[model samples]
Structure formats: structure tokens, C-alpha cells
Target: MMFRKIALTLLTATLGTSGAYAKKAPKFEQAHQLTSEQAALVQKSIGQEKILIKAIQQRTPLVETYIQDTRPDVKLYQIPVGDQYTLSRVDFGKGFFDKTYETKDSANKKGWFKGSLASITGITKALGLDKHFTYNPTGFMQMMFLDPTGFDQQHYVFSYVRREFLGSVRTWVFDVHPKVAGMGRFYGRIWIEDQDGNVVRFNGTYTGPKSEDDSRYYFHFDSWRMNVQPGIWLPVAIYVEESTRDGEKQVGLKAQTHFWGYSLKLPTRDSESVSMKVDDAEDKSEDSTDVSPLQASREWVLQAENNVIDRLEQAGLVAPLTPNGFETTVLDQIVTNLVVPNNIALSLPVHCRIMLTDTVEVTTVGNTILISKGLIDTMPRNEATIASVISMELAHIALGHHIDTRYAFNDRLMFPDESSFRRINMNHNDHDNQEAAAKAQQYLDASMYKDQLSTAGLYWSQLASRGGVLKALNTPKLGDSLLKTDGTPWMATIAHSAPKLNWDDLAQIPALPLGSWLKTDPWDDHVHQLNAKLYAPLNPRDKMPLEVTPVYFRLQRYDEAQSQAANAAAAKPNPGAAAPANPPAAGDPPAQPTGQPTGGTQPPAGTDQPVPSQAEGPQPQQTGGTPNPQQ
Candidate 1:
């Protein structure tokens, strides 16, 4: 429950005020006009009495609130999660009662007295009240509010602080402090209306838990009352403020309440003859109005669809095919085939529109789908690739990938910056769920048009060949740099590592590269170094062109297999390392070196052959003479 403290010290200040003598009873006037010295003594006496009464009252019957038997003009209700996107109003008939009060005067002259109460169901459900809400009264008043009975005589210290005016209300202020240490929760000023000595406002600061640091928490309250009868006042409105801190930052949390519907006993022989009616009601009241859950769901879907479509067009994904081109082609196709069918399948309806943007990406805002020209350009020259991207995004929407109740009604769902997009990933568990989704996507992709499936595979192969930004999929912890659209380290890496192919080969392909439609930085130190170190080792025969593989496809497993084969080829033993086991050709001398040709004079030209060296054992030679050692 929301807590609001009404200062009691101010009540004493109001009653202690001095005024001109009147014909009132001498005892009453004398009691009201105490000399300065007498005032101090009387305050001590009253303070002690109050402490005693509070202790005794601690065990007495605590008041229970009941709704007055009357109709209320307005009501407020909290929306449940899941359906929070649609704020529906619920009305619980006018014949209802809410809070009740005890009578102070049988004649109904003085205001009805009641302790304050507050309903926190909405906040409790939304954030779990126990986790987020705490009562932090100031230091001097802590014991008084919490213990209710642990008051020592030395703790009864009250001092007249001041007299001031708040809004249209004149009040007398006073300070109440604990005479002894560790006796209370608050040390601050309170203001009371002079007319009837009722608390009207209070402001104070509270210290933290006794064992923690002595940091102060500030609080304030203002109460407005209606004159229910002559010389009587009853509270009709209250506003409270409490300080909240997050790390080093602090902010104020404010709450307000308006009371209506009052009941009073009638002057009848039977005390049971009591009546109630709306109290000080206003023309405009906040009341709950009911709405159908199904209708609310439909509205949310429609909103999502609109939001996505708007973002797509703004990004220039869909062709702005003239005035009606968007409606006639892209939007029409989506409504007929995608949105309508999906709505029927899910038992949820949606209204969707498509927009064309120049970006090479597809993203969603609510139910709205955005497709970009760059995305189109990157696709293989076929319908399959287009379907693949669209279907993937559609799956995300159908599964509520990016839906957030907090931001359901927000129109600015598009990524404001890279940081925000990163936050989205951090908030969602997309990767953990992707494997399961992929399995399902495979079937969906196959069941769709054959052309779409064929184009999808072609797109995948093309992107695999091109080691552009998509190459990040192959390396762990390397893709973040490649996702940047700006010409930075990521873009440079994509450009340097992209597979190269002859112009003739590219021309023969049906699909062509979109060029650098999205500009990126050319200078990347890591990219340059990696390229320099790797270029010489890559075999021309094993090299694949950049345009053959789809970036989003899972091809790393295949790439790893190919890399293992290449490594094995490089590590294989060389067959030529050992010496040949063959004898020298005809005319070759048996002994060579310094005594070469000693036994046999000179060998004929082209016929001379030397004996094979020990390193090169006897082996057959293709030529007549010994083959050159190098050969």
C-alpha cells in the first residue's frame, strides 16, 4: 500500500496558538493562552500524555476501511500484462462503496476521523510492490510510526517551529524531535490547519536503515479537505512525494489520490438509520471502462502492421512504385498471401502495408514489414531469394520476436542507433532459439513456390562465394565488425576478404553484385594484416568467388570441412624427397671425382653418363646419360 504520514505535532501547534480574549469559558481560554514559561511546561505535560495514550492505543482496535454505501462517478483499474498493449477500461457499476471513516461528533459537526489508506494493486502487479516499494519515514518520527509503543519520557520533545501559509490554507508549524538517540525515524516540520487543529501538510527527511549509511530520504505531503458540515472538515484529496535513488542518482516519486462518496448517521431513533452519497464529486472523474480482449488484440496487431510498413517505406526497401505502386504490388501481395492467411491461422487479425527503402536489410516494426532495395539487389536474380528473406522476417513477426509490452504503443520502434540495436540483441534470446526455428523454416521454405526455393539456394551459394560482410558467419567473435554499415574496420575487412573472380565468369552468371551500395570504410588495420598473412597460402584451385554463398545461411560447417582437406594436402609427405634407386646410363664412369675418366678416356658427346651418387641410388633414367642431379 502507498504510505502517507500526517504529522501530529502540527496539531498541537494549532491548538497552542494564542488569541484575543473572548467570552468563552475561562478554563478553555486559560488553557489556550499559556505564558512562554507555562507553554513549555504544558507542552511537556501534553507530550507525556500523548506518549502514554499512544502506547495504550497500540493494542486497541485498529480501524478497518469499508466502502460507504453510495455510488461512485469514476473508477480506475490496472491492465494485465500480455494485454497491456491495449489499455481497456472496466466499469463496476455506480452502486459501490470504497473507503470509510469513524464519526468524531454524533452531531456531524466535526469532520469524521480516519487513518489513511491506499490501494497499490496496479503497481504491485506491474513491478511487484514488495520489491520496489519501501516505507522510509524520517529519523525523528520512525519510532513513533513503527513501534507505536516504545516511547521513553526523555523522547517526548516538541518545539514550536513557525506559522506559515500553504496554498490557500493557513497553518501553524512545529518540529518534533526525539529527545534520545535511536528513538525515531524522522526530524522535520509539520503544518496543521488553525481552525480545528487538523494536519494539512508535512515535509521531512528520513535516514536509511540504522545499520546502513545515514543518508537522508526526503518526503512531502499535501491534503485537501471539504467542509462536510459547519466547523467540520473531511479530506477529499491528497498528494504525496517520496525520494528514490538509483546508484548516485535520485528522483522523486509522486502519487495522488482523490476521495469521494461519504456516509453519515441520520438523526433517527434507530442508530441503524445511516445514509451515504457521493461526496464533493467532480464532473470529470477517472473511471474504468471495459473492452473486449479479442478486440484489443486485433487493435494491437493492426498497430504493429502499420508501424512495420511505415518504417519499411521510410528505409526505402519496397519500390515506391509511383503513387499507388506500393499499394498495388507489395502491400497487396502481403495482405492477400501473408497477413490475411497468418491472421486466420493464429485466430488474430492484422492490417499490413509495405514500404520500399534503399537499405539492403529487412526489419519489422510491430506487424509492419520493411524491405529494402539493397536487400533486393543482393538477392539472386530469382524469386526464391526474395521469398527467403520475407519468410524469415514473417516468421519473426508470427512468433512475436521483438514484441515488448512496454513499447507496444511506441511508434519509434526503428533502431535509433547501433547501440539500441545492440541492446535489442542483448535483451532477446534470439540465438538460443534460432536452431529450432531454422528446422521449421526449412519446411516452410520448401512448401512455398518452387521458384522461391530455387532462388533461395542460389542466393545462399552466391553469398558463400563472396567473402563480404557475410563472411563473419564463418569466424567466431569476428562478425560484429562486419555488421557495421559505415566504412569502418568492419567494412574494410569485408572488402579485403571478399572472394575475387574474373569479369568473364561474373558476366556469365545470371545474378550480379550490387557493388558497394552501402558505403563502408576502406582502411582497417586488422583486415589489412589478415589479408597480407593469408593471401599467399590460398590456392587458386580451391578459391571460390564471393558471390556464390548466402550470408545468413549456415555454411561454416561445410567451409570447415573444405579447409581440413586443404590442410591435409599441404601436410602430406613428399614422394621426391628420397634418392632414386637407379644405376648410371651407358658410357658413365664407374669412378668419378678427381680421378674421373682415368680408366676410360673421354666419353663421346651426349653419350657420357656419370655414376649415380649414393644419395641418388640406382634407378632407371629416361635419357641415355645420367639425368642432371637437380632434375
Candidate 2:
């Protein structure tokens, strides 16, 4: 679910009082029309929604999110692990339903929030007044408007939007508003597939009650949906972009949420290997030693690389599960673009892997390039920035400054990541590093990315403004710096087209935080696409690039999962209940269900103390977007 707290004083803005310099001055006109068929379809869904919602409340879909809060004061700084944004994150499961909130903010007295324009009180409570931000019982499903009560005529006014094809499905879209402006009412647009009339997507915010002090207002949002089953339209993602005024200043912030693994309980994957007997085995491809000794040795190295990859996957540190499924495809597109233009080819295909960590680094193991999820998240949002990183590695490959065959021993697969770093050496001597950098420069000049290096230069200029903090990102995970040598920047022509970097300039966004553009699964760790919507926060202070948010899952798993959680909570005292207890066996205390607190009079368990689990904390990221460079 998306939460928009930036204040837009529609009451004043509508009165034509704040138009002089208001960024989002004109505002989206609340105008719409619906055909009779569309109205009937919507009514039908509203009546039957409760039943579908009940079923949804039973299953759990994996939830993934990333939030980035950027402002002038939120500069890159050395924070414990490394230089990072004034950022916060949330990564958890159960669609983020029935989840607790956490933050990286340590010093907590009367902290002023940077993004509160609509609801200053709400932000004040979260940052200064409340012990911690908590999810309301209504839960994230509220974001989808599946609750029948929400759509009743007494509360909402609906208007027909248009008939548009979202993908192959033609849909009837509508604008929604609350009869009265209050937190309980939803405001936005909804898309319904013409055939079923099920709400395919809803984009907007709920009406919040007027503040007595007149200090808060609701922020705008865009929610979306996807068909998971034949007749089931599931809410897949929510994007929130809020712009609010803080006194005379305006602020902006961006946030994204994702939901997947809906049919996860049912077997979604099948074995691709064919069943075979001993006879089939005897006719297998070939023996490893069949090739010439030199060729066989190279084959051994390849097999070893595969082994290392498999080990990383099992450890939850590789692509798809790590930086997410997009890494492989992204690497492929880059390689395709570079290889075809530069006429570079290899005997075996090159692969890319991502490590899911906050460390900014990159390295190559055999033909595969390993990039940290953090680096991908922090880099300037441009294809050229990515190409620059890849070119350096490709240069190393071309110059043959590579990992020795020492790791060809499959036994090395058992080594841990830290230990393997010492054994699977991919670093080059300083002299070789310089040669690779020079060669990488030449290769880029001869490739398609060369013309775009001016933008790539802008990236380097920004990175350099971090005053050496970005140098770590330039440093290879296992080798010498790709963009820096010694203490000075090495990409001399990297910023050929961009303006100078200015860290203190609120008008300029120098760099994004880790995971600003990518999201990771809290379950199987698969990464997926966040809705690529844009929100230009009119006020720079409201530009929160990466911030912590309350977890609001699309559904709370109250069916069997609720029973399981209850059984687990009930059995907590007796640590030995083998069978799952239902409805509290005999004399035992009643189990606190998923949404409600066990001890009613008291607040939820983590109200006072922050959640300690990083994986359990609230997460958010900036949406990945950049103008596509012309080839």
C-alpha cells in the first residue's frame, strides 16, 4: 500500500491564493464520465467485492519495496558500513501485511520530518511524537478499494475515465472521490477490464479528515493491478508522489511498492530435465577429458565458475534472488549493444551476477561480471553510467588481466565468500589496472556508448562531488579502481557533457541511494520491477530519495497462516505443541489473530523499541528512470 503525506492545500489552491509560484499549481482536474454499462459493472463488483476480499485475506503474496528520500541536506556520508544516503529501507513478507515498522534514525528527540506537507502532524507524530510509525488495522487492501463498504454510494463519487487498453486487455477507467474529505475515503482513478468489470487498478489517495490546526493534507498516489487468475484482478503495485508546502517552501517525495508470488502455494515451477535411465546416461554428451588438454583445462575453469555460481545461488547471494531477475537481462542488453558495434566475441557466452548487499563494488569471475546490488542502486540513473562500469571489465577481459586458473579446482566452491575472495583472485597489479583503464577508454571511444559518455561524464562529476565517498563505488570489489587510480578521479573524459557537481545545491540531485531503482524479495529473494511512475516533488526538501515507510501488505494471510501464527503464538508458552492448535485448545489463552494485538489495552509489541531485523524493517526506493540515449 502507498501512503502520501505531502500537503497540498487544495482548499487554498482552489481559491487561487497560492498560484504565483506553486510547482503543481494547475492540479489535475477532477473531471470524468461513465457509460451505463460501465456504471453497472462497477456496481456489480462493489457488491461482490467482500467475498473476493475474504479469500484474498487468506493467502499471502510476497511484498517488496524501496523508498528513497533526497534533499539538499541529505548528502552522502560515511555511515558505519560505508558512505550512504540519509536513507532508510523496508524489506519484508506477507505482502508487508501484519508487519512492524523500523528506521535507521537513531537520535530521536523532536526530529523534524523533511517530507510532511499534507499532514505535518502525521509526520511530526512519526518523527517526533509517536514512538514508531504503525500500520492501521484497515491494512493495505484499503489501497486496492476491494472492501465493498468503501465503494457504497454514501461515501464515494465515481466518474468514467476512458476506454483504454492496458496491455492486451481493454479497460474502462474511472476517477474516484470521497463524498466527504476524510482519511477513510479514497481519492484517485480506477481501471476495470471491460469483460469482467473487476477493478484492474486504482491510482490516487484516500480522503483524510481536516486537521484542527490546519497543518496536514493528503498526498496524491497512483495504484495499479494485474490479473492473477481468470477472473481475479489483483492489486500488484502502488506508487505515491507527494508535493506539499512547508511554510513558504514546497517539498516532494517518491515511494514504490510491489506484490508477487500470488499462486505461490500451487506449484509454479516444473523440472525441465528429462527422465532417463542408465542407457540414457551412457549416451550423455561427452567426457570432460575428450578435448585437447589445453581446451580441457579451460573447460575445467568454466565448470568451476558454474560451481561457484551455484553455490552463490544456494546462499541467496546471486542474481534473480539477489539483485533480482533483471540483472541477467540488463547485462545481456549491454553486451549485445557493445559486442555487435565493437565486433567483440568470445568462445563462450559471458554472464552477469549481482550480490545483494550495500557494498559498492564490481568484479568479474570467469566470463561473469559480479556487481553489488548497492552499486547498481547508487549509480547515476543512466545507461552510460552502467556502460562505463561494464567497459572497464570488458577491457580487463580484452587485455587478459583475469583470474588465474587456480580456482579451477571445484573444491574451491566450498570456500565462503570472504575466504573465496582471498583464493579466487581477480585483481590486477596497479600497472595492469592502468593499462586496462586506458584500453577501456579506447574501447568506449570506438563503441556506441562513446557519444553518451558526456552524460556518463555527468555521472562521474556527481560521484566525484561525494569527496571520495564515491571512490569506493569506483573501486572494484576484487581489484583496482576502474574510475579512479590512487586518490584522483581517472575517468578524465567521463563528464564531457554534464555541468559541475554541486552537493549543497538543493536544486541538483547528485546521486541516488542504494536500491533506489531496484527491489528485492523478502521471501525467495527474487527481485522484480517496481512501477515506473514519475513524481517530481515540486519542493526539493520533500525529495526524499530513500526513506523508511510503514509496511502495508496487499493481503493479510489470515486463512491457514493466521491459524499457524495463532498456533505459534499460543504454543509460545508450551514450546512443545506438535500438532497445530486451532481456536485455542481448552484452558490456553486465546491466540491474538494477525491484525489485532494480543493485549488489547496495550500498543503493538514493537511500539517502544525499533524492529532489529533489517529484513523486517520498512523499505522504499526511487523509481529507475532516465532519458533513453539515442544510439
Candidate 3:
């Protein structure tokens, strides 16, 4: 797993080192020039960049950045040594400014981002990555824009590469570099969609002024944007990586930054007001019986749950509830599979929601369970593993560990979105978690997943082994950490029985890498299972559980009409196609087998298998969750 040490100078240079610059001499004979049509597209892209900048200024979005510093490891190849995390709601109205959301120490600070000129300086000071030599945090953010002030033919030279397809959008590829040696200039390649001439993706590093080594101050990054609205593209994600000499040692870092909550500023009425008193409205229940004492107590707790969930959603911390969504389709089935077999009866049905962060944590805000996206992404695509995690929160519900009743008062949740982590507390106490853990075991043993406990146990073992290095990732912002205070995972009982860790065992996939299963929609903040070809691991090194990997998006445009048309076309049968065996007649219902309802619901992929392979290989589809409607 040792990375070949590369020269910092060559790693941070412009395309000149690759002969692209050498080919473009004074005579321009070996230069690659853009055709008239391509030149027009480039001009349109320049204007679109300006439009994107202006549009972004009108909205404030949440920006989350996570960094993992790695040194070479003999066994695991490269293991993280240190990590950093920062979450903020950035206001780009007049300049780059942010209100910290994940930390209370700097929650009230107003100077995270000052302006364009000193933006890098503000970010470096805020991130505190280095005190001796500053590494620009804004360098990653600036990847969203080619150049804020100047991004045209006057300042940059564009050479045509070719036409390419990024997901469903066809793009014109071009390599660009600054015309003169200048400070903070973008030198990289861009992918511009052919339809609107908007830059869909850009990858490279920023160049420093003459005589300065850019590698010390800048990092290589790949930034991607999504068509959030018609003719409006916004930055969605950025992946940054750097390997350079820190003193005599070869040190490297990998980081990712995600942006969402674009429509946070849009005006909408409060959801709580929808049930306000209406004229001549009467009770709808036929019995007209008074609510019992038990029902009243439960309703009181439900009030607190509803308040917190609503507030989190409004603050862009939780995804909007969508029917047949990931939670409803995949997670809900897992809950049912556990509850029905255990014969657990509840006064109200349990539900789940995803917290839109890359923290490995889970908690119950009353009966509703909240699991972070990072936890879901890292878990092996096995039903028992996911069920094991969910069963703990389900135990909390059964044990009646309710959220604090104070939150039922609407005024308690009136604080700003930036203070969400500070104001709200949903994590369970140690005693309660211990009790729930024991109860969770009881539920798992009585359920259909009893036989697969060994596989689920391996996940806990893998998590416990990496707990020391991945502290920041495992630390929860709004919920409970899976590990106890002494570093043992809460489900230590399961890990104790798991098969011993064997690095050479390629088939033993303890956990999957981060971003393996779920992807978030930038515009709507919806989480969906990735419809990707799951490949079996070629070696044990391929199973990089809970590690930060490079980000590659299958970029596509947002077109509602085109999407519907495609869906309809897919549903239409071929005229010459042969009929299925015993096709149902017209106007008659399709026959469904007894004991299993047709299309009623299907479990998340791999419910029947006790041990599912979690690897990346080129073959038939592997086990995971159901495909999203937008697929």
C-alpha cells in the first residue's frame, strides 16, 4: 500500500510539463485550436460562469468539509493519522462569509470568510490546518468558479480536447491555463455541457505568483456542479488531495467538501400551521371517545418528536419526507422485518429519517430513528448488518426512552440553523444505551437475522479497530456514537463472536468504503441508493471500510420533461417482443402467489443471503437497496 513518492514540484505544475504548453509555441503550428463552433461554446461558458457566481451570491448554502491526513502503513497501505471537520452555513451575499454550525467554540464568530481577496486567508485561519505555512481552504471552494474576476480569452488560453459524456450530459472538454504568471489563477481542465455551455466539472490546482512553490500553498482538486435549476448550475461536491514533503517525511492528505441547502432562503409557510382550527370542523373519529391517559402521554412525546424533526428539516439538516423514498423503501422494510418476527407491538408505527452529514452516528428522537448518511454508506450491503444497527434504536423506542419534553414548546427550537448542534441534544445517556444494547440483542436473536449475526459482528470489529484513527468521522454531532467511552463499540457482544480479522481473506468484507451505497441530490437534498455495478474485490486492499475515497459523479442535467419521456419510453414494450409466460389478460388483475403479496413490498437487496459479498467488480448487479425513481 506504499504510495510512490512523487516530486512536489512536478505534481503542482501546469500542463507545460506535459508538452501541452511546449506544443503551443510562438508560431502556433503545433497548437490545438478550437473550431468556430467550439469557440462560440467557450464564449457562452464564460458568460455562464458569471451568471453562476451571481446566482450563488443570492443564496446561502451549507458547506461541509472533512479532511483525513494519512501516512504510509505497512499493512493497510495508507492509514489516516489525523483528521479535521468543519460545517458552516456560508453567506456569499457580498463576500465569502460563514456561520459555523458544528462547533460551539466559534459559533458566534463572524469572520470565517472576509472577501474574495482574503478568502483564502480567512479559511486558512478558520481551519487551522497549519500555523507555519498556510494551506488555503478557499482554494477548494474556489474550484466552484473558474475565476471570480476573470475567466475569459483575455486571461486564459483554452485548447480543445474532445467531446465527452459525463453521465447523461454531453460536454465539450478543454484544457486551460493562465496567459500570464499571476497569483491565485486557475490552471486546469473544464467540462462544459453542450446544451447551455455551462461548466459541469473542473479539475486541477491553483497557480501561485512567480517564484512561489504552489505545492506548499495549493492542493489538487476535482470540483463538480449540478444543474439545480433550468440554466442554473451550482457547486455540489469537491475532492481535494495532496502528497508533498513535510520536513523529511512524505505526508499526504485527502479531503472532500459537499454543498447543499440551496433553497434554504426560499419562503414557505410553516408545516405546523396546516392543521390550524378551521370553521365548523369537528372530531373525525367515529367513537368520539376521550383520549386515554396512555394515549395522552404518548401524544405528548410525539409532539416533541414532531417539533424537532420539523425544525431539523427546516434547517436543512434532514431530508424532506418523500413517499417510497430510501427510508420508506429500504430502511422501513428492514424495520418491519425485525419488528414482525420479534412480535413487538407499538402504539405508533416506527419511522426513520437520514441526517445529511458524513458522521457515523445514530439516535432516536422519540420513536423516529435518525442515522447519518456516512454510517449507511460504510455498512456492508447486507440486511442483517443494517438491521443490527437499526435494532438498537428500535430498542430505545420499545424501552420508552423519549426525547425531552421541553422541546414540545415551539419556542425552544427558535434558534438559528447555525446553532442547531449547540441547542438541540438527542444523544442517549450511557446507562440508557447499555440497557438498549442488551434489549437490542434480544430482538436480533428472536428475529430472522439471527443466523447472520456473525457477518454483522464483523462490521463492529472493523469499526472498533479503526476507531482510534477515525475519531472525527465517528464523532457524532447530533446523535450517539456507536462506540462507548472506553473505545469498545456498543455492540461489543456481536464483535466478540465474529470471525477473527484476516487481511488476506478477500471474501471477508467487514465493511464497505464510504460513499459506496448512497448519493444525495444537491438540489432537493434527497438520499438515494446508487444504481452502480458492484464489483467483487480483486484483493483484500479493495475493502477500504469507512475511508475517504476519490469522488466521481455520473453528472447529468435536471430536466423534468426529458426524465418523464425517458421513463415512458422504458415502460413501452417493443412491438416485436415475445409475450411472457401466461401473460395476464386485459382489465384483469395479475395473479399473485399465496403467502407473498405481489409488488406489496420487497426487502432491501440480499435479505435471503446470510453472507453477502461487499466488493467492487465488473459483473451482474450486487446486493444493495432498491433503485430510486429518478434512476
Best by lDDT: 3
TM-score of 2: 0.48
What does each candidate score in C-alpha RMSD?
35.5, 19.9, 9.9
TM per model?
0.27, 0.48, 0.80
Q: Which tens-of-lDDT digit does each residue in 1-631 have in candidate 1?
A: 1222332231212243575333322111111333475345434434443443333232211110110111111221111011000000111111112222111112212111112111112112221222322232111111113123332234434456566775445666665444333412334545555544544343444322331113332234343433333333333333444443444433333333322222211112232234879889776545745557754765565454444333323322222222222222232233223322222132222222222211234454444344443344444333334444555555655566644443444333342222322222202234523532453254333443333343344444444443343322211110011122222221122223333433333322323333111111111100000001112112222222222211111111223434753674366332222111221211122223342211111111121144223233222111111111112
- Worst 10-residue lDDT window for candidate 3 reads 611-620
Q: Candidate order by lDDT, highest to lowest? A: 3, 2, 1
Cα deviation of 568, candidate 1, in Å:
61
Worst ten in a row by lDDT for model 1: 523-532
Note the Cα lDDT for every prediction shown: 0.30, 0.47, 0.70
How far residue 344's Cα lies from its native spot in candidate 1, in Å, is: 6.2
lDDT of 3 by residue, 333-416 (tens): 577666656656555656778998888899998768899988998888787888899999989987988789888887677635
- Clash tally, candidates in order: 63, 38, 3
